[model samples]
Target: MDLRVAAAVSLLLALATTTGAVTFNATNTATGTIGGLRFDVAVGLDYANLVLSNASAFIWSSAFNQTRPADRKPVDAVTLVVAADVSGAAAFTAADVITLSAPYVGNYSGDVRTEVTGVLFHETTHVWQWDGQGHANGGLVEGVADFVRLKAGYAPAHWVKPGQGDRWDQGYDVTARFLDYCDSLKPGFVALLNAKMEDGYTDDFFAGILGKGVQQLWQDYKANYDA
Candidate 1:
């Protein structure tokens, strides 16, 4: 074997090992009807790792613009738990742990697998994204997470179309759509914005990035649709 070929193979293996180093775990705490739906922790863990790896890359490119592990959150493990008593189909994340309502899993009218995958992507974003030291708007935080979900191709059927939001920070799909517009105006807009949010958040972030206030940008976004 050529020395160059051997060195290339060694580099690839090291990269793969590093990428796969993050650990994922899943648990199901539901019983009865919900538990009967067969929560596969093994499969869920595999998918979570895949989504986490991919999301980190996409968000790094789209928001953080850094690929080094040191540039990311220091978390080395993430756990996905299924809970029976949570209200609504809503999911939440705390630190490195994500909890999905088992009720939502059992009651989902469509493909549960795809729905869960999307939920994992959104929740996993919460695990990795910086929060402006808890000073950023909650709407923007959720929107950024959903932005990852949107980029990952897991956007649900009911998401609002582009240029359809009432405000730039209305949050979730609305804010995600608006952020998407902002990114269109300048590539890596989200990445630069997220970097700014690391210390704290300001409305000026919009002006700093695009030379326009968020409100004016929102107006332009809505106007584009009106045209």
Candidate 2:
């Protein structure tokens, strides 16, 4: 074998050994009613794997600070299910599967394509983000997910503006805004905070990272906007 060819093969083998496998599937259970929406989400599905991969990379870059695949979640596959049965929620992710509401797809008044992409980006983050070993504040967990959405340029027009939330851990867009503020104070603040939460969660993580209590940070955040 040629020396260069042997080296190329060796590199390929090494990459195959180190890289993780990720799969994505999008299914529409509300086929009949979905009509054109089905086509839109199907298009979204076509890019689901790419979206998941990109979202994972973004999540790690934004919060986890884990550049290597080995440092992130060991999820092997993610499935997006669009169902009409889910009511009162646009979407929810459990484990590695994201279930989107088909009714939401059917009734969405605005840009369904972009909206679904945003929802997918948000839900996909849930599949990759740490949950403080299930001890973290639920609001913070949700906030991190929305923060991913925010960074992806998928933030909807209705989302609360920065420094507009009532509390730091208020969850969703509110907490996302607060987390963004925290991240602004120091680069990669979310990433370090997430790394600390890998084992478990503590309020001290805030003071340790930003030199201020979480409540104090919230107060400062609010004061910045005179809110």
Candidate 3:
């Protein structure tokens, strides 16, 4: 290899190492059906791995600011399985494993690759996020994942708009929108909350960070964006 090229490669590898080099393994285990076949056609294992790398970079640098390994999950690898029979959900992550519903891929009417990329971002967040040692609010947890997807510019059109949900912790897009609002009030608010949840979670953390209770913040968020 040319010396310049080798030096560039070394630098990239060094950066990745500093941020924690987590292996991403992606495979389609549902190739018995057309849904799985569609995954192979629209998004092969190679692209899935790329999304994993991209999502990790985005979560650390842009969304969550978890640039250090100690600030995020310590897993050494994350696996993504594109499989069928995963009904009633587009994708979900358990521990360091992400399962994408091949059936959803086949049935989706939009850009399959783009949708999968967005789903990958959401699921990847689950793998890296601090979960309050399994005691965090489930809705807030899901919302944070969706917030990453939202920040990635992949929020679907059918999602509820700002201030549309009945509660701040309504989960998914609702809570994601609320979090976006919170981030606006205090830059890096989501990142702060995420770092706080490294070991435990409390609604009171809102007061510590923003000088207001979570409920009061929610009310202000609603009033600010309600149409």
Q: For this target, which candidate reaches the highest TM-score against the unseen true structure?
A: 3
How far is 166's C-alpha from truth in model 3 (Å)?
A: 0.4
Q: How much does each candidate deviate from the true structure in C-alpha RMSD?
A: 6.2, 7.2, 4.9
Q: What global local distance difference test value does model 1 have?
A: 0.74
Question: Which segments of candidate 3 are over 4 A away from where they belong?
Answer: 1-14, 17-19
Q: State the lDDT of candidate 3 residue by residue for 1-227, as single tens digits.
A: 01122232344345766767688899999998888999999888998887887777778777877666666677899899988879999988889999999999999998888889889989999998898877889999999999999988888989999988888888999999999998998999999999899889989888898899989989998888763
For model 2 the TM-score comes to 0.87
RMSD to native, candidate 2:
7.2
Cα shift from native, residue 18, model 1 (Å): 2.3
Clashes of each: 1, 1, 0
Pairs of residues clashing in candidate 2: 63-191
TM-score of decoy 3: 0.91
lDDT, residue 90, candidate 2: 88
Task: Say which candidate scores most in lDDT.
Answer: 3
- All candidates' TM-scores? 0.85, 0.87, 0.91
